[model samples]
Target: MLAALVPLPVILPLLGAGIALMLPGRRRLQTAVTVITLVVVLIISLALLFGVDALGTQVVAVGGWDLPYGIALVADRLSALMLVVSSIVTLLVLINAVGQEMADTANETPVSVFNPTYLILCAGVANAFLAGDLFNLYVGFEMLLGASYVLLTLGSTAERIRAGVTYVVISLVSSLIFLMAIGFILAATGTVNIAQLSSRLAELPPDIQLILHVALLIGFGIKAAVFPLSFWLPDSYPTAPAPVTAVFAGLLTKVGIYAIIRTETVIFSESDLRIPLLVVAGLTLLVGILGAIAQTEIKRLLSFTLVSHIGYMLFGVAMGTVEGLTAAIFYTAHHIVVQTALFLAIGLVEQRAGVTSMRRLGGIAVLAPGLSLLFFIPALNLAGIPPFSGFIGKVALFQSGFETGDWLIYVLIGAGALTSLLTLYVIGKAWNLAFWRDPDDVEEPTAELVEEFEERREALAAGKAWKAKPSVPRTMSLSAGAMVGVSVFVTVFAGPLWDVSSRAGENLRSPQTYVNEVIGHGDGS
Candidate 1:
């Protein structure tokens, strides 16, 4: 029974996507199908999480072919947890999108295009998490890239199209590199199955192993947006519609991070890439936050901070210890919720004010107290304020570094600390400029900014700016509020979640367990 549940997370969304596509003109029915599919996925993911914890790793070989040749879907603690969180995030973002469509008659994000593509994106994410082979993971990345291209350029505006082009080019380059790495792995080890590669990789020459490992890292690195490879993200992500941006900010890059975690822990378990990862983590942190401090637009700032916090997850991975992996898992979960919530909240700001530039936004605290509260909670949470999950995750990661006692890790600890402080400063600056000040005192928008805003408004709906309601739709606010609540739930349940993360971390550090479950049993027991 538990084994049967492993494949549904990927299958159901795909089925729903097809069904949604068939119901082209029935927006209500399409939404019903999409919601029911995701809600079921959420329940199954929660069951998988508990089942994996109770029953140990669950693996299902597709079509009953034996491992090393057939495709396999495996769910241990890490993948199951990711599935649960992702299901939750995707469902809420969908709700937010539905609300936006209902409220905005201009059809900024057409339901016909959005629903099916979004479901496909969810299936791709599930596939990536459950993929037990390198080639399958590449397929998952392609699924995401294909869907994201359509979603990113939804408006067909010149600005969005340009950003989408840059995004597609960068993503295609990364995908090609990933495909090459898969070929190299297959050529070198005679297998691209992760479990088999685990043992076979160790037998190859050290130099060959290092080359394969670095190739894989570079490919995944570009996707994860680790600095240097991160320049495309800030520009690409900020141009999408609010719900699209929210989901992308929250989930997409993390898929790359997840792949990197699997690569470091399972395939190259003995390789010592720790020091280099640490240096990269430090640079990622400093460089990303520095970029955030320089941004005036709310979405752009959040985008930079998104890159900055990826550093924390990378920092935890660089520690290369069970404690470190645990913290990385926890931080990944926390960042996903907090970051998605922040974007949704900012989406509300954009909807209400018709702009997200801090210089032009003010008095939101008085005008829209609810939106203010939604943004305030996640902003503080993202900055690692105490009593929130962000703080809890950061503290756990810092503790893991301290446990390592390496001077370089010590320097990273300092970098993480500085990054946190600067995050707070930037969040504070945005709050003061956009929320705290009186509307009358806000700076007037420049002609260029006004022209851009007008273009966007017109793109969203030809002339609806004059006819649309001034107040934000309640559904949009509720969706954002629910996301904020989930972030809080993570904080309240930090203890149990940490314990689960620790177990997942322990499982990751012990590659033999994964191998034994997938290959040793041979029947996918």
Candidate 2:
């Protein structure tokens, strides 16, 4: 029964997608199926978390095949916790998307493409989280990538098409690099199973090991949007539909981070990559938030902030200690919730104000206090204000860093502090411009923005523009509020969640715990 539960999270979503695809014209059926699928997934995810806590890791080898020979699915505390959080976010995003579809002409046809594509995307995320081998993980990445290309280019606007093209090219390059790395790993270690590789990789020569490590890092770094490899993210994410952008912002890069964590802790635990990773983390944080400060548009500013905050997770990863990794896990979960809420709230802002450029938005506080509150709470949480989960997560990382007492760690710590303050300043800047200032005080767009808007308006007048002026749906507001509520719930329940994260960290630091569960302690004990 425990084995049965392990693969259900991935399988259920795929099954739902297939069913939804078969009922293309039945929007109500599609909605029911998607909602039922995710609710079941959430329940199973929670059960898996508790099951792992009580019974240790649960592993299922598909088709009754034995260790390292079959496609394996394992649910430990980390994966289960991530599954639960991600499932919640995906479910809410689906609700938000449904609201959007009902409000937009994009889904006015008898058959809508959004439902199946979204289910596939969720399936991919589930598979990535539960996969026990590198090849399965790669397959998961491709599934999500394929779905995302569709989502990114949905409604087919000129800007979206351009952004999607750039996104696809970069993703394909990264996937190719990742696939090549897998081939190298299989050649060097003779297996792509993470458990088997963990044992075998430790025996390879230092130079061969370093080569594989570098290859994997480069592949995953681009997906994770680590500094220098992250220039494409800000451009690609901002143009997608809001719910799509919210989910992508919250989950996609974290999937990359998850892969990195598995590689560092499970496969190449002894690899000498700490200093380089630390340098990347410090640079990502400083450079990312600095870019955020320079942005006049809310979406673009948040995008830069997204890149900048990835540095914190990398910082925890670079620490390579149990406490540090625990903090990373906690922060990853917290940021997923907070970041998605912020984007959804901002989506509401754009819906109400007709633009995301701060220079053109004002009087929102007086017009829509609910929207302002939704944005305000998450903004503060993202900036690491006290009593919020963001602050709790960062505090954990800071404590872990100080315990190390290294000069370099200290420098990174200071950088983190500075980044947090700057993040607050930038978010506050957006709030002041978009909400507090009187409408008459709002500035005009630059000549370039004016020209672009003029062109879009002309196209709309000529019936050539893809986007219609959106009417803000009540469901949209509710969906965004639901997400914000989740973030707040994290703050309220930090103690228990932190304890779970600590346990996850301890388990991760010892790779053998994972290996023993998957392979079963030598010949089924």
Candidate 3:
């Protein structure tokens, strides 16, 4: 079972992709495959979590070759927890996308686009978590980026195309950096195998190892959108379709953070670089939120906030302690749910009010009371108010950072809290402009070319024909409701998830165990 488990995450989806390709074009089949795949992934992740909890971390060498001779797949608490969280995010958001099409209800924005690519993306992510070699992790990342390049531009609207191109270009550059970094690692250690590198790494002198670690950091840093490298994120993410935007917001970047956490713990644990990471984390948090504060558009604002929160996870990673890492892990899980909900809710609002531009939308409360409430809860949750999972995550992260009694961390925590407060204010600004203000005063849109807009939207909505809309489709409302419901679950289930997250943190801090399982007990032991 353990040997088989190593391949399940990757194998299942590739098989599903084949099935989806052969099935048909209805998209219903695609939805079925995606939902089932996500469910299976969730179960596998949970199984891995509990299995680790009970027996211990496990690894399987591909082709049954010995360590340093073949690829490996590893499952530990941290990876398993992330797998489950990401699976849920992807599944729910994909459903949200399909639900918006309204083929069953009224003619919506005229399309439906949930299918095999999303499944392939999920498969890629699962493979990333399970990969026990550096090159394999790189392969997983490339697979996902390739799938996402299409997803990001699913609608092919000019704005989305422009944003998608920026996204692809930036990601390609980062991928190249990652590849070069891998080459460096391979050169230094003569193995692309992660477990072997771990043991071989300790044998190398400290100064030489630091060089390799720096290269990896730059590579993952680009993906993590660390500080200066982060500008691409806000630029590219806001323009994707709703479901694509939501998944990108919630799941995609987290993959980067996940890689960061993995490499920092698994590959660079011996380096005295936590302080540098801590500084970078603090800057990312402050800068990201501050950027949000300046944005007038709802999607752009959310993008900024998203950048800022990445800091919390980095803080946890930098702490290098079990408690700190656990807090970060917990926060990561919590954020994924909340972020997806927020983005989906915003998408719903955009569809209902007929605009994503905050300047153009107003007084949704009059027309969409339920929608307003849906939006409010997630916004507040993302702002980290009490009784919400976001709050719990922030508290855990802050507490962990403060425990170190490092003034820098103290400052970072204080700033983080302030950013949370202001995140509330900025989102409130959007809420105020979009929902609370008078609706009647909304100037009729001057979209003389909106018919063309509908035509393209219809095509991207899955090649369905749709007439110009006098009214918004109800399916958008239903999709929003489903997404909001998931957010509520996160707010409610903060306890059990946190427990699992803490265990993940503990497991990650003990990387020796991960290696032992993957490569088997080594001579060093």
Candidate 4:
């Protein structure tokens, strides 16, 4: 019965996307289908999470073919948890997008394009999490990337088009690398099935294994926006519409991180790449936060911070211990919710103020206290303030590092601490400039800024799109608020969630369990 449900998370969204595309003219009906599909996916994910916990790993061989030849959909504790969180984030972002459309007649985002593409994106995410083979995972990445390309260029504005081009080129390069890695794995081990790779990979020459492992990391690292390879992200992500940006910020890189976790724990369990990963993690932490400190635009600032926090997850992966993996899982979950919430809150700021540049904004805390609270909670949470899930996850990671007692891990602990402090500083600076200072005190808009704003307004007016006045839509506000509430929920239930993460981490450490469940008790070959 449980195996029957494993594919629904991927299947239902694709079905809904098809339905939504068929009824493009019927926005209400399209929205209803999207929402109902996601809600069901969420419910199914929750069921899978509990079911996996109680029943152990659940595997489904597509079309009833046995593994090593057939596609497999496996849901264990980690994948199920990711499904649930991704479902929640996507659903809320959809609502926020819908609300933005309803409230603003001048909105450039087309519901016809957004809804179907968004559903396809969700399906791809689910597919990646539940994928049981390397080739299947590549297919999942393409699904999401195809949908994202359409979503990213929704406005067709010059800036968006330019950013989308850069995004697509970078993504394509990464995809090419990933495909090559898959080819190499298939050629070397004669199997791309993850379960079989667990055993077969170990038999190959050490140098060959190292080459394959590095190739996979480079591919996944670019997608995750780890520093030195993350230059595309800050430029690409901030150009999209608010809801699109929110979801992209929240889920896309995390999927890459999830893939990295799988590669480290499941396929190359005995590889000794810990020191290199640690060095990369330290660089990622420092460089990402330093970039954030230099940004003046709210979205761009958050984007850099997003890259910065990926290091924390990578830090856990580098530790290569059960405790470390547990913390990484917890931090990944925390960052997803908090980062999405922050982006959504920034969306509200953009809607109400018509700009996200800190230099052109002020007095929000006094004028829009509700919006202020919406931004504040998530901002603090993202900054790793105490009593929030961010703090809990970070502390867990630091504690795990301490337990390792490696001198290099000790240096990483210092880097993580500095990253947290800088994160707090940047968030506070944004709040002061955008919210606390009086609007009257803000510097006059530059001539170029004035021209850009007027051109945008004139374009909308010329297109018969300038109907609604600038104000936060009720639905948009509510959606953002609900996302904040979800972040808080993570904090409130940190104990239970940590337990689940611990269990998931344990499973990851013992890859043989994953192998045994998927392909029976013998060696996965």
Candidate 5:
């Protein structure tokens, strides 16, 4: 029965989501259930973080079925750490949603129903983390994505709907590509189970294996928003409700990165994918961040940043070494936390400013000093400034790149440095406009307050004077608090967390320990 705990991370959220709907619609009751369930899931994730074998993997067979036929849940270091990070980000985002009566950005929808939907999303993410087979991974992706469809379009405004349709369509196509890739894999190898396929993959001819690898790469690359397949991301992400946007920033693309890592390191052990990933990674970083440099909207800038950083993780996977993979894993974990916090902080800015464009916004420091600081810290961390988690992650990644001793890798490192600087410059440009600039820098003809006052005065002339409300968002305070808290946690505990990430990377590259443990090798207790 204890062994059955392998499935709990996935099942817990699914179970809790059902129970949440069963509860009465009282806000307090719903919040309690969501908080408690998420907390429990977080605890399980942390337990796995500590208890899972650093060098081994664990698997649980459902319904007592044998390996090939039964559904299995596997947890190695990488999945456990991902589960922990995902659970933490989900809880923090959920808390931010509940604390502020989180409203839809485009419209005024309430936050009550968001609880159940968010839990479903968490469950789907957990399933993806724990799934032991290719088909099950697809099921997890679909489950999580169906939840995402709701999250992305929660408010039902016209722009949101338009953006949501693009998001949904792009997502579905990626899934279809993934399914097609899996079909090819199953056709060639005759099994969809990862453990089963692990043995069988080596039996296939090298050329056929490379084709399957390329197929998987293309499909997952689209999901990761890798270069040439990344255009849909910036368009859709900016319009989502704030918390939904935050979670998407944190979790969604990383799932694609996780799949890419798993396929390159585990299912397809050949070094064949390295040079291709090297090329993809370099291009992804250059193209995505360059797109960011061209953006004026704060949210849009972060969206491009998300696409850009995926390249760092890809860099790790492409090196195909323990140092490289571990560094990549570390970078992935750090970026997930940092990215989620950054988006959430930006959500606060949008909430208060009532607009996302830096051109139309200013004087946040005057009105929201706390929030300005919150935004500033994460923005700096994201640009890889020192003493923050992002710098540490980037250093680890850069080390791996240099160790490869490839000139292209060095050039990629130099390019990564340039991208970091550009990222800082773009974010700095936003900061200057929104916080540092004089009011005279307004893009429009008049300051917002002045314009609003004039409109009110004109209305008064027509006897229609209603006092104008300030643009500050109600959830603004909570969003800042959540993101700031995450940044602090990452900052304060960098050492232990880095160690955990290192062990996770080690587990991923040489999966024999994981496979042997999952199959209950001769060391059976």
Candidate 6:
């Protein structure tokens, strides 16, 4: 019975995508279908999360085949938790997109492509979380990648086209690398089933195991935007529309982080790579936030901070302790909501104000007190401010690292703290420039645009007909506010979530339970 529910999260969204495609001419109908599909998935995902908590792991072997022969969809504690978070974020972003489209005419935009492609992208993300085999996971990645290409280039502007090309080329290269690693794993272990590989990989020579581990890490690291491999992200993501950027910023890289967590714990638990990961974590932290400090554009600054926070998760994961794993899981889910909310709030800023460039924008706090609240809360939360989930999550990781008592771990801890301070500094700088300062005090980034807006306002006030950009849409503010609400909810309910993370960490550290549930047996000791 539980197995029957395991596939619905993935299946419903794909079905929704097909249905959405037929209603492009009827956009309201398409959006209704998309919303209904996601809402159902969200309900199912929540059930799965609780269901797994009570009954342990649930597996659906497609077409009734068994073991390594079947395509399996497994929902354990970690995957189920991720499914719930991802579903919520996607639904919220969908709401944000609908609000965006409602503010403009369909002929002036591309609603036709956006609706179905968005659903497809949601399905792909769901599939990636629940995938139980390497090949199925690849299929999930491609599904989302294809949808992302469509979403990224939706406006068809030259800037969007250039960014989309960079995004696609990097994605394809990453896919190729992932595929080659899959081939190597198949040759070494004779199967791509993750559950089966848990045992088979243990039989390979030590050097071969190390090689395969590094290969998989490199493939996933690029997707996760770990420093050095993350150059494509800041360029590719910001060019997309606001809702798209929000979702990508929040969920996509975390999927890669999810893959890394799965690989490290389940496949390479005994491997000797913790020290190298610690170094990577430190570098990722310092390098990423430093880049953020140098940015003048709001979106680019957030992008860099997004990369920087990945180090906190890596810091937790690299420790390889149950406490470390717990912190990583908590932080992953926490950052997902916080980061998405920040992006959505920034989107609201871009709509309410004419520009996101710190050099040009000001007086937003005086203009929209509500928008100021929305941006400020998430910005502070991202900086690990107290009473918020970010602070709680970071503290957990710091405790985990401190327990290790290693000099390298200690140094990484210091770097993490410094990175947090720098995150606050940069985001504070953005807030001060974009909201607190008077508009006239700064040079207008786009002088002509500002002049035109001023003239239009003057004309309207003088009873003359003048076209002006529409006010921020109600739905957009509502959707972004919903994310802010969710972030607050995270803070309010941190204890329960922390408990869930602890249990998930326990399960991840002990792969035998996952193996037994998925494959119905484990390798003999």
- Pairs of residues at least 3 apart in sequence or in different chains that clash in candidate 4: none
**lDDT of every model, 2 decimals:** 0.91, 0.88, 0.77, 0.91, 0.79, 0.88
- Runs of candidate 4 with Cα error greater than 4 angstroms are 102-107, 445-470, 521-525
Q: Candidate 1, residues 324-443: lDDT per residue as tens digits?
A: 999999999999999999999999988888899998887667566778899999899999999998999999899999988799999999999999999999999999989887655768
Deviation from native of the Cα of residue 361 in model 1, angstroms: 0.6
Question: For model 5, how does the per-residue alpha-carbon lDDT over 294-385 read when each residue is reduced to its tens digit?
Answer: 98888898999999989888988888888888878878888888888878777776766667787777766655677788888888888889
Give per-residue CA lDDT, model 3, range 197-309, as digits (tens). 77778778888888888778887888878887799999898877777888888887888888888888877767668878888988898899889888878889999999998
How far in Å is the alpha carbon of 290 misplaced in model 6?
Answer: 0.5
Model 4 scores worst on lDDT over the 10 consecutive residues at 444-453
Question: 331-414, model 2: which lDDT tens digit per residue?
Answer: 999999999999999888877766899988776675677789999999999999999999999998999999998999999999
Error of 1 at 184 (Å): 0.6
Per-prediction TM-score to the true structure, in the order listed: 0.94, 0.93, 0.89, 0.94, 0.91, 0.95
Residues 288-368 of candidate 6: C-alpha lDDT, one tens digit per residue: 999999999999999999999999998898999999999999999999999999999989888876678898887677567
Worst 10 residues of 2 by lDDT: 102-111
Question: lDDT for model 3, on a 0 to 1 scale?
Answer: 0.77
- Provide the clashing-pair count of each candidate structure: 0, 0, 2, 0, 0, 0
Question: Local error of candidate 1 at 441, Å?
Answer: 2.2
lDDT of 1: 0.91
The stretch of ten residues in a row with the least summed lDDT in candidate 5 is 103-112
After superposition, which runs of candidate 5 have C-alpha atoms over 4 Å from their true positions? 53-56, 103-113, 445-479, 521-525
